[model samples]
Target chain A: MTEATFDACIQAILKGDKQGLRDIYDAYLDYIYRIVYGVVGSREDAEDITSEFFIKLWQQADRYKAGSGHKAYLATIARNMAIDHTRKYKKEVLESFTQESDDDVVIEPVSSDNTEAEVIEDIAIKEAIGKLNPKEQQIINMKILSEMTFQEISDILKCPMGTVTWRYREAIKKLRRYGYYEES
Target chain B: MKNLEKEYKDQIDREVPDLWSRIEAGVDAYEAEKKAAGTAPSSTPVTETPTNITPIRKKNVISIITRITAVAACVLILAATVKVTQRTKSESAAPAADAAMSEMPQNTNEPENIQHAEEASEATEAPDYISPITEAEADAEPSNSYKPIAGADSDKNASPSLSPSESAVIKDPVTFDDARDDLLPQLEALGFKLIKDFVFEDSVDKRSLSDDVISDDIDIRVASFTDSKTSDKYYVVYTVNDDGAADILIVRKADNTGDILYTNPSYKNK
Candidate 1:
């Protein structure tokens, strides 16, 4: 995941090197999977988007500017793929059932992470994350899993930094209130 | 809250499946597609979703269109086959019917389905216009020289319901021709020479024929005779000629079933 390695990967991709893509996939799989899983809340959907994300990386090697952050570029694509998947899935559901605008429906997700599902792997914290709204889970996954900054989160979410931080703080408070942690 | 965040980060992350095989295959396919598309002679910048051209969906659309085109081709072929079959039947049917007609003189198998032809021939052969030749007359005449002038253009709306005025619109050419031709020889057998054959428009008020008729256009031909020895007025006839179809046949429909709202004797028009 070093800048030099990332640049080499991009160069190899431009030359149609499958190994280069594999190297990138190996590094970012968990990070990207968490981003997709956090948004879509389904392991199956996460794998599809994650696999597709690496292929897009290989295909769009030319698009990545050398100096800009490589992980950020990847995170953006992952978030977009997840968002696009959600929109499409919602649209299909709407079409199959009845004609109603999907924008009106709030996205309340039970997060993919689970504390009770296992003792290790931050089970309590992960379970608490699940109780948070879908966007909150997405932001927390980006923050904790990918180390994306509040400003970077704001940029991707297309909102103010303050709003991103407020959601992050609010998400933490909601997790605590769910009784995994005592009231501060 | 800080403890929770610390604990969340401290815990080992969950591992996703080692998708090396699937992802590598996908990436290889993607690179192969890009290489192939790059070689294509076009300049639109490619999209990034790695599957901008959805393979299954594109196939489905083409499949539906192919099915539609196949159906259209089938319809066209079936229509052509039907048309050819009908033509074969018509061409073959006409000759066979003519043969059957030649077999019987007075006894045409006038099927009830052919209402117009039966009514036209039978109803119009009233005692006033014709009298059956006697046995002595028949003995002198050749048996076949007097066949009913084969069927008139029966499709002409020769309705039995036609007003006498409308009925007159159709000149009895077949009846007149058959009778004249048959009788001329019989009269000659007795002793008479045909003096002159003249064709003139029947001066009967042509307007009564129909609004579509012009008096000048109606040709009424007649043959006059005198006795060879006595030179007495023997016979004359209104002519019936089939050298030309009765009138201009106007086939306006694709069915090739031509139509005429009304017709009268005229120089046969196509």
Candidate 2:
């Protein structure tokens, strides 16, 4: 959805355009999926949470305030929903992550030519992302995957922008230590 | 700004399986449940509003409902018009339909009201069926128990006393309402959404399709003359979401459907 369409989209959604919800979903699904999947570190739990997250979008579209960047707003909802899901099924999700093990976490060097598709290497990055605290994980993912600005991250997190950028910086250093950084 | 998006963007993280469709399914289920419960399902929004809807938002909600109601009504009328016109096309049906049309109380009823009054009047005459031919015939087919309707108003002469004969049809003066709800979905299913439908009081080439009638696919056409040659034309307009891209379709009144003249991608990306 375009920035200009926030009001129209919200109104259409409330008015029962499942397509309107689809439009919002089209715009932010990957972004939200990235956030939740980054944090949960399990594709299954992430899928379940992302599905519930948008089901929430349908039942609660009217709650969306006009003029707020829907990306930031939706990312926050996704982040919170994933956190709640992990907390509820913490043992199961953690056990699965630990069992998968961090042997995949050894990231390969970023090739000067960045065209290689990394299946295991991507898992390494996700596993590396999984190690950060929830807040740190979210800040970095929102910035990178969601293309959210530091200010919007701060607004969604309700923290200082300085803290958001700093946490993202620290998260990157941590991921680099985990061998996830692309030097090129 | 150094970022992971460009570097790892192309890297294959296991892409979620067509995630939107799954989310769409979830929404469909929620809506289905709300419908089954006899209460409308409200969607979930990311920003949390209080449990109680704010008064201003409440008004917005009411307006949304009203718009939907209006759209549904318009679809009903459009569907009715399509049915009646299509019925009139069949062989040997014209004279009776002419009777129905003449019997039609053209006295100031809105198109919808005229439609309902026609259907109600038709219902009074032919009590067996109220729906259109395809729908009725679908049920009527392969059934030994069913009797085919003789004419559009087969029972007109039988029910002499209740007849909405010329005078009675006039006396009742059924009033049709003009408002219609959003039929964007139906329009989309028809292959496009009508951004506008209207008669331009002046040269239409300069005027765009009116947005006021977003839900109305009602076709309006007029014949005029600049010298002696007749200048008759028809048009349809459609808009796509996001890009605000629209296409003006030149449609013939003989058929409600239109072909895309071309698309104007001017609505978005400004």
Candidate 3:
């Protein structure tokens, strides 16, 4: 959706219009779901968190300042909700998941009732992503799924922009090595 | 690659069930919850109290501490000023009093009259001390009544984590008032007169500091000080970024260059 339309939807939501939220949900459900799914790696958890994210947006619509990048705003909230969910329920897995930080963004292959060929291809991509450490997987998810800038990702991750960029480059390199990406 | 990104997004679209219905239901449930709790969600902004209480508590603690410190400082300054004024008044009045006594008839037998005169003078001068303390109390009262950044209270009520602009008020390592309080004296001592000091509530579009137009999406505090001798101006730009890092720079008006007076170690290490 265009920034103008997104902003209008936020304004509408602020004014207590459900249609505005519906418009936003219709526009960005896949976008938010993809980011959440990428972080949590469980379809059920992703669904739960994605729903909570929208509800959160509905509740906190007034907090959104007009003219700020709504996509980044959505991505930030979606990603945070997903991470928070992981931290809440899957603490043990997270404790051993990474020594880097508490943001244990584990991207396992999600089992879905898709055609075998599609499932296989999806698994290949998931496996490729899963090969990297949790941090790299997170960088890949945000960069690819949400198309967040390294700086935006850095802000979200509380890491330096230089480190974000370097990690993104490393993740891309690893993906290339896994034969998923062709060098441009 | 774009293909990988597209595939990943598309796969999620195909795999993850649309939770819009559940989300819609969740919003309905939230409204109902608010209604049951006796809050009309439509009229009042619904605050998630569980997450909000901590930060508001923290803000209250900080605000109270700041108010107490301001009142204490004001009291100390007033006390010092009163002490100096009293000393000066006694020193000036000594010679005049001696001359007046010499011009008067000897009153050694009427020491009670002298005591009465001194008591009257004390009674008259007592109000001056009382008035300044009252003025000092008046001055300290406004510290508790700062104009909060626009929507800042609501923002604080809404979320534990602050938005970029909102965090400018909350998460800055050193706030504008604190910086001004500390730096103004140092700047004055360095022979600089404060020209203008203000905060950019929104992201500055293009603030020309030392010929450089800064358009970063960070809340900035700009304090301009003029050199007392040269009348040359220096701009102190204190930026509080969204990531909770802050920086302060001093830029010379003539040179069009700035020196980093302070950088948050988090920012510098990053």
Candidate 4:
């Protein structure tokens, strides 16, 4: 998970070390997939994008210059691929799901022992996050979902550091207002 | 700040695991496919120099140079023809206008009024003559003539998107040329061919402009070369912003499976 270890795996991948590729995959696959899923908003699309991202990795493995945070780099690739997939298919996806009411739309609830409680909490939190401006939602997603640092998020969002910080704070306040962090 | 950061991090931790798993499976599948294609596997050892690699580099440089020259030649020819036509029009038309002016302007009594009327008439006729000439000149210009050179030139000025340390791996003096040369054809095989140079003003933030943004931005250009036969001719151009470390924006196209075919990551116009 450390940057050094990750870089080593990348080096190994470049050297055509199959085990290295697997190791890199094992370490960060979940992180990359989740980030893609967050953007694509569907498991199927997320799956496709994730696959494409890695295929890209294989093709351009030589191009992944080291010292660029390898995991961050991979995450970025996944995120872009997912977004592109969504854009390409947005019209079809929107039309297919148009029949479903907002209230009927069910997102997977967080996994925990308190399934019912967590689902209620998640709904409240998601709704609160949804209420925020689009920029805020993006900020939260970049910071939380993508695990991008403030600086990285700032670069991606093309905003001042202070602005990223403020948006993150505001989004958190809104989510907390919905009792997102209230221990049952 | 620390507390808030921690809280946000925890929230992300809770939401991310499930989604991450799905992406992992997708990457794995993609990697598996590349292995089957005999495209350099990620794990391919770098120790031995492959004999086939030499021709690929040479071919890439030649093709890129040829594409550039061809586009430049087309533009120059178009410009020359336009100039010739403009000269002919001016030669034939100016005398006619001058003769008409001389025949009408002998009286001095109403000089101001006459001059005003003549000037007004010339204003109306001027645009009429000039507009068509301009349009004709524009029409004579080959549309795709500027494309390849623009891409090639932009590649020269593009910022190094990868950090120095990262770039160092390929910077071995002996190998840099080889590496640069190797890059283009590998890209070509992916189904992209350089077409034009473009400057993208990325107002999107650094966080939002993740590698995904990089890929998607490139894909937008890729999608434009819509020919099914050129599906294998993927082309990409990339350039870094002059002022910021805002990573280079590459325009790329891919083959049918959407694999990247061409990339010029350093295609910023100077």
- Give a tens-digit lDDT track for model 2, residues A140-168: 65667555678766654555676666667
> Per-residue alpha-carbon lDDT of model 2 for B81-109, expressed as tens digits?
98777545531232322333332222222
Q: For all candidates, what are the clash counts?
A: 2, 20, 0, 47
Candidates sorted by lDDT, descending order? 3, 1, 2, 4
Relative to the unseen true structure, what is the C-alpha lDDT of residue A74 in candidate 1, on a scale of 0 to 100? 88
lDDT, model 4, position A75 = 74
Separate DockQ for every predicted complex: 0.16, 0.15, 0.20, 0.13
Which residue ranges in model 4 land beyond 4 Å of their true spot?
Answer: A91-139, A147-174, A181-184, B1-43, B46-270
Tens digits of per-residue lDDT, candidate 4, B59-154, equal 678889999999999999999999788646543444333333332223223334323333433443432222211223334432211222222334
**Each prediction's Cα lDDT score?**
0.50, 0.48, 0.56, 0.47
lDDT of 3 by residue, A17-122 (tens): 7889999988888888888876676778888888889899999888888788888889888877877787788765455423444243333343443222232232
Cα error of candidate 4 at position B174, Å: 63
1 or 2, greater by lDDT: 1
Error of 1 at B23 (Å): 1.3
- List of chain B TM-scores, one per candidate: 0.27, 0.18, 0.25, 0.20
Clashes of 4: 47
lDDT of 4: 0.47
**TM-score-better candidate, 1 vs 4:** 1
Model 3 misplaced regions, further than 4 Å: A92-124, A127-139, A146-174, A182-184, B43-270
How far off is residue B72 in model 3, in Å? Answer: 24
**Which is superior by lDDT, 1 or 3?**
3
TM-score of every model versus the real structure: 0.37, 0.35, 0.40, 0.35
